[model samples]
Target: MAVPAPRTVRTVAAALSAALAATLLATATATATAPARAERQHRRPPHTWTVTEAAHAPGARIALDDTTGALSLAVSRDGRTVIEPSPLGILAQQADLSQGLRFLHRKDRAVDERYRAKSGKRLDRRVRMNETRLSFATAAGARLDLVVRAAADGIAYRYVLPAGYGDVLGETSAFNLPSDAGAWLSTYRVDNEGRFNQYTAATAPTGEYSDQALFATDGGYTLLAESDLTGTYSGARLAHTQGTGTYRVELADSRVHTDGSLTTPWRAMITGDLATVTGSTFTDDLAPASKVADTSWIRPGTALWTWLAGGRTAGQSLGAQEAYVDYAAAHHWPYEAVDSGWYFKKDEWDVTDPDWRTDSWMPQLVDYARAKGVGIIVWIHQRDLDTPEERAEWLPTLERWGVKGVKIDFMNSEAQSMFQWYDTVLAQTAAHHLMVDFHGATLPKGIQRTWPQVMSMEAVGAEEKRTNTAAHLTTLPFTRNVIGSMDFTPGGFQRVGLRPNSDAAEAGLTVAYESGLQMFAGTPESYDQRPLARDFLDQEPAAWDDTRLLAGSPGQEAVLARRSGERWFLGGVYAGAAHTATVPLAVGRGRWLVQTIRDGADGLAQDSQVLHGGDDLRIDVVADGGFAGIACPWHPGVTTCYR
Candidate 1:
């Protein structure tokens, strides 16, 4: 949808004056002699919201207070109620409240305009205030209450969804401003079409504003944030998550004075909370009926095969199959992926033909991989299915074929229609009991909590593309990875050629940085040649029961530690330059085994080595450089096992 033009300061002032006059006139008519008394009695009422239905209610209220804004909302079976900080002065001043009104002009652009129209008409002008309220309901008689309040500097919103909705659908809160106001603006859309659902839609007038969108999923809740139009793709944006029993989106009014692509400022956080809410929380709340053999399906530790290497004939290559099986068997890795070309054409292959059954070598290869204890994950493109019926038709067949999961790729990111598609795909995929990995998509929020089968996703470009740099990889762990698992296909066979000082060390560090399902991106030949790195890949976890953001900040240094069984894996990355940080050893107790990789002091080479154990180790590393260490209890039973 198109963004409306921003009104001029003069126009905004005039509108405010008009609105205030109307409010004053109404107030005078209601109470001519008691104006002062009424004004004095306008204090906030006590929180009276209560849960009326027992089974449907989550029975919670969320309150937030920040320098820029404050918000309060309640959740119950009946519905949600919200009260935001209203700009009382503006309402009392503006003359024509709708004078500066703007909306998306109907046009055929991204999708057919006819199919993309708003489901509801423009809300009554009376309800249009600086403070806003939104309510959502589920078929189970549960409801959500959203209250938005404006602060001196910005705005904030809070809400709680009923417990039995299974998962949140999608949410978007847009502002309709004046059409003629001359201002620079832009648009952004983020969606994880392949994994746990993450999608966003935003618009600005000139398409020149900077934007940043973030999604975080913790526990059983999701948080999303969107910053206002800025000039560059960098800035601080407020975010709220379900772990905190709230979702907040904030926009800052700023000017564009630099040269760069217009990026949106949006943040999303997802988590689950049975008690009080907290930010950056992760929870798992998979439906009881939908839970699979968690041990059998959710294996901890790496995969040897990816679709990129096999190229056009990936699906039908016996050599690739043998290579993958060999790598898995030799390394003790549990999984392998049959990327995009498996079911359909490699470049322009179609799924309709029977190449796999007759002409190609897939039948033998699939059987071979199974024999070697390697589970296969196939690749499916979002565009492959035109509608929900087609998805329904194919998913069941995949499940029957014993396909462990599907990697869906190349989804339209920024449209409302596609948002619905994202939600539908997750719902349908769950029905078939198949795992999912999203590629070429937006960042993940917290879908994993509600649907644990969504293993990982690829939003940021990883080692597979060849263009990604050590700096880019470093930025992800702190920024994107903070939200959840990223399918940054690591472990490329090709050595680092761009920076001589950095070799395979960056790749190794990246693998450790990503605590999600690990996909090794290099060819089987490359891995076989390097036994040491190959050994590390073999022991990597497929999924983590818990993830701890030990230390770091967005676009800076990041240290993440994840546990599976009795092992604790830690990875730290720094972007562009060198830095020092002290990280705590909290994964377990007693003695442990530690392996590390850090930049060499000579400044021209990265030192690759291992260390057995140290209670607390001091680490000093250079830019575009970091370290990876795995701490396993020196003796069994000394540390708590994640398994």
Candidate 2:
């Protein structure tokens, strides 16, 4: 073989020698010097070469620089500066895959459009996608890639590491924002035990992690979020960077195991009008395709939760749960959730205890509920799901005993270990064809697209906390529920909101919130006391075919319209003062029966009218109250045209 030229050999030798000397120097100073250690730990190796690969969509473009591995995204239709070329890289134990990496070849492809989630807050998201991959060789000779995608919704990027084992040290790249942009950051815990905190980007506290960070610009909004997280990765947080409005990604835990090759969760930056941003369905689009062979068993419906009624029961025991099941049966609910303390081992909630609590109560209740056509879902603590044996042993037993699902609770952290464990819970439960609902858990990130059996996650600071306000209820559709299913337990019709005269927010919540399994949290007997309230609960569903935002903003009034099958449900909520607005309908041709219920002098007022498609119906919501009801055409097929 022919040898390389002298100049080329000299260049290679110089690079290798420099890299070797720097490594040696870093190791030499690792012993005693703190500054030296910090420098070695934080310093990024410099890159000497550069090239850019870019792809454009209808209104957006994403460009990746091979030189510094920075990704710059632009939403150009509005002529606004979305992101001004942000550095994108990773830090790992074995290699600083950040900067100072040699560029390799790249490949580009486009994802063909397809439709899923037929309708919800959107008609159907046509998956228009353009993807590019830039390969690199780190200074330590490790291989990695920056995979970028430009879609109709926004731009997404992820790091692709070769099959290996090590801790993912951190991020080398950050999202730099314009100085004028304001942020809407949230500190609401997915767990039921926390308070809600919302603030702007610049004033956001350092070191705290927010599930969703929204930056509002003059032209539109910019969203920084993550999705499709699996067992290989931990939950990620958007942290405030030192710069005026810069933010960076921080993994709850960076230690990762790439079964062979690993693809990090998508680092997404979505931009557009409130409607565009709110209606975009990229969270589901970016997730892995479903792995289940038979998803027919997966069902979505309303259920009754027993835990929140502890205040009513005062004493927790088997009789209280049976009473809830009786109401579920009477109301025609599809399921009932038997909350924690159903077993002897209250601390660890995995399975049956032969000696202490394997009483006939659970079996009798399960059989009774099943006989009544209502399924049973039991609540279990997360601690019991610590191992494969634990999962393997209990889930099958529950399945054999006719338990339909499990509300897995107490996942207090979003660390990498929790991510793996969460995956195990879903997979194990799915293997037995059982559904799941997560409580005391991290905000769910698009995993439901892969596992629809995961009905809902309790991530919103909702009614269950008893601190929910009209503002909180109104803000959810635009923030928390906009990204994923929110288990905002409703139906305590007697009271509502965090302020006075708030009783009217209940019906609005039942109609506004989106979840696969809607579990009403108050005593079932309390609901049965009022026929109108019980009737509304019986007529409602958990998930919908289509959803549309009608009015308001965060912490303000909200009017939303949803479609299930062919029927339409609309609801609105407001606080501080009385509200009235003319609502536009997107329903197609022909007239329909519009039955509505709003706040009344004493309880609730109900009215009915014939409404034609494209009608602008004006509604008056009194102070501290809301509205909710249905609109269905007398003639179904002819009136159900696309809007």
Candidate 3:
């Protein structure tokens, strides 16, 4: 069973009231209950002494040295060290006070909290954890508390600040692996849509906003990211903490002020083997529980976006959008996101474009989609709603027209001011019952928990990556996705890369990636040209009940398996090595008729087989090619291969 979830304010207040009333009624006629003075005095909270500083993940420990005050990590392979010494430090604007911080008191305890996740690779219906908290104070009247949580899967920690704890500047929390460590780090962009680049830890770019840091040591692989965001605080990025030979947490701005108590987000580090790194759930682990009162409207499914499908299809305007609607209705996709130029004349940014504000056919389009059992969502530039009045002028009209959602785009920065505006937009859209998708935005930071209506964000280099390759495809499942929901909008069923195979390769992304809204980036007409490939695309799902990293690694190749309801779907890609692909069936124990799709005999043809799932299954993969299809409980007369 899932633990209690976060709810709207009123619901929380009501629950508290009911509990208070129950307590009053039960004790109203009874004598006051009290413990003996001696017993009461003796019952104090648990304490830990001589634990001035420490770091621990299950079955591992890195204690802080008293003389040096360096809190660092070390990776060892069977007693062979793979990392040089490094440290984690808390820094503030006041230098003397920063040095004054030291062990003043300590408390530790075991903890287990279970909660349901709204959506992710893993359901996490129940979360069990053990925590240790240490408190430190400076002579300058400022104090900082570190809360560390050790779970079987990963380790997470954060700083807790009491009221008037002095203004914190930032932290030195980067994983300082050996200088020679292999790494996969995304470019540091304010837009955060940069592609993953392979390099050494020493050569990884700094002085920018790279939300997560991932690297490989001879000891093991480690992935780092932040979670459980505190709204008032500015978001974080990475920068060279000069002379330390490591990147450090750089708060977005110098205006990190607090009037009352404030807690920083958890900086989580998931360290282990390849499977452990790829399968880690530390990011979502630190996310706050779902808080929406009624989440039925926040549905997950595939979508069709016109911008990705060549804005105007076959020289048809309204016909193009109608075709998109028809495609959704035919394939069971729930929504269609009609991108820019819907209201404008191809490239007009004016809000009052004659075709838009006055006589745009958006209302008629919405009505047409409704008749076809499809919901229509439109896009807008963030500048159009720079003020409340501007938003009021159109948000109501769109809602009245039965528009299902809106995609706000071109928010290319992560300044504190932009952060404030983001909160405003989320609240405003929810008030008007408008689901939202953020495009060209900052990396997600737990706002989805507070606002479930946020479907997905385009903080990743997806189909827009004109230079995309298999290396990029294989790396994303471990980096960009580890932080939050991404609008990959995958599926380009053609040989558009540095390889001969395309259909099967691109098709694999359906299972390789997860998003609340999985919008495909291809024309319906183009996909329809390839019927079998089109059928395969039609069956892909956006969310899953469970996810497994089946085989392969970052950059070279990868295979992923995801489950939805009773059926299972698997997708895998082999960049340049054509070989036998091994798939592990971790689902229910039964005879499953796996109608598989694999690279053709010559790497151009598509082949299929009906295999029984009693043990691991292997399929032929062509060099620079891939495969993806589905499996279900064996039934009569299922087709093994497509004609």
**How many pairs of residues collide in each model?**
79, 4, 0
Which pairs of residues collide in model 3? none
Per-residue lDDT tens digits of candidate 2, residues 1-643?
3466877889999999999999999877766598766776556543332212233222434454454554444443245666654667777767777666667777877876664441234435567677777777866678878777777667777889886636677775677767557666665343523443455556666755565767777647666667888777777766674336667777766565446667888887666666667666777777776666678888888998777756234324556667777778888889988877776444333335554434436677788888889998888888877788877767877888888889888888777777878877777788899988888887757777777788888866767555655666666776667777778787765444433334446777777787788888766566755555667778887767777776666666777778877778877777668877567765557887777777777767777777788888777678767777778876654432222
Candidate 3 structure quality by residue, lDDT tens digits, 79-140: 44334444455665543232345676657776555655555675554555666676766656
Write one digit per residue (lDDT tens) for candidate 1, span 1-643. 2334344666888999999999999888778758666665554342232221133322333332222122233322223212111211000011211112111111111111111100001001111113333343323333444543322111233333333333222223222112221111112324322111122212222221212232222212222333221222222223332222222332222321223212223222221221111113221110112233342454334666456455445434557667767777777777777765565444333445765334444555667877888777777788865497888767886776666777888874533345446667877777776778887664454445445566776765555554555545544543455445667676665545633224334444544455345777777767666554555555566555444555554344556666656677677766556556577665655666566545455422323222334345556666566666566666544332222
Model 3 lDDT, residue 26, Cα:
65
Q: Can you tell me which runs of candidate 2 are displaced by over 4 Å?
A: 1-77, 113-126, 138-141, 188-198, 241-243, 254-260, 310-316, 345-358, 494-501, 634-643
Off by over 4 Å in 1: 1-279, 282-301, 308-316, 344-360, 414-416, 465-471, 493-495, 498-516, 528-530, 578-581, 599-615, 635-643
- What shift in Å separates residue 440 of candidate 2 from its native position after superposition? 1.2
Per-model TM-score, in order, reads 0.58, 0.83, 0.82
lDDT agreement with native, every candidate: 0.45, 0.69, 0.68
Give the candidates in order of lDDT, highest first. 2, 3, 1
Name the candidate, 1 or 3, with the larger lDDT value: 3
